[model samples]
Target: MKRTRVALALAPFVLLTGCGGLSGGPPSAAPGTNAPPTVPRTATVTVTVSPSTPSASASPGSPGESKLGPPTSTREVTVRRTTDNPPLVLGVRFAKHDGFDRVVIDLSGGRPGYSAHWVPKLVQDGSGDPIDAPGGAYLQVTVTPANAHGETGSPTWVGGPVFHAGLGNVRSVVKTGDFEAVVGVGIVLDHRAAFRILEQRDPQRLVVDVAH
Candidate 1:
């Protein structure tokens, strides 16, 4: 009877093995049980920045108006001859600054008396030949008691009768003459405008500023 009972108990297990119900594997959750906890996913994001560009029609002192100055007028100016002090012409130079164009005449020995005036046309000092000054207006600059040649008759300032300045306002400088202990410089302007003359010491220089 014990062997008969043992066979009956082993019968259900043998039947479960035939049906593949006891395969060795991990246990699954019950129908109503919560699923295994899932790890949260993370995402990354990036951002970019761009620079701003300036536009046209922007007002002065604005971003787009950088590196530029306001326009100025060109009025007539003159400096009369005071004393006859002979100065030797050393060199000439030009510069563009602020609201004007500057022409500098370097001198040595002594500062000479000068006369600066606007003229309808530029003419040679002794020759009276019409100077081909390339500008709408002309400034006649005369330096007295000055010479382009030294006492030994050697040239101090020797160059062409016409010098191309090509500055802001002054276009050309014409060497009119070095006659009668006087030196003449003709300034050609792009347009007829206001101008001023200044004399500075310490090495002595004649400065001509024309409005741009």
Candidate 2:
């Protein structure tokens, strides 16, 4: 009876040791044995992309925007600005584009009035002499209330009288005249085609694009 009572007293201490350590952490690895490391569990995320469409307001071909086909005329293109201290013509330049030929006229002082149309022939202002510009058809771009000089009478046009564009449609461009308050730029093309005009600001310039 005395031995049985002693055994019962030590039973609680033996139960605690059989369970894990008191701190409740993972058990230590066996001595001198290779143990594997514990790696954290993670989730993999995936993302999908979608294509964007053109906006409703963006059309196929518009002024200043290029496209695959020829230009379409929006009625008769004309801008008339009458001023006494008119815009001065700086220079004339041209280049060949994807579906058209471009001609640019640089200007300053102010925005000037302009008239572009198919003319039978181009004539020199004041002198009335006929111009023998290259190409078969003539498209005359006339800027009114404009000058090729400033108040000091210094010529603003550095390279003029004529320029050979040599594009798909346009053959050349010529400064037919700079008389009175008007300045003329004649576009010589292989034949008449649909053309468009654009008026740009900031520095103020006139652009003409002929369909190829």
Give TM-scores for every candidate, taking all chains together and pairing residue i with residue i: 0.61, 0.65
Q: Write the per-residue lDDT of candidate 1 for residues 88-137, one digit (tens) a residue.
A: 89867777777767778888855455666678899988888898776888
Provide the clashing-pair count of each candidate structure: 5, 0
lDDT of 2 at 211: 75
> What is model 2's C-alpha RMSD?
32.6
Scored by Cα lDDT, where does model 1 land?
0.61
Off by over 4 Å in 1: 1-85
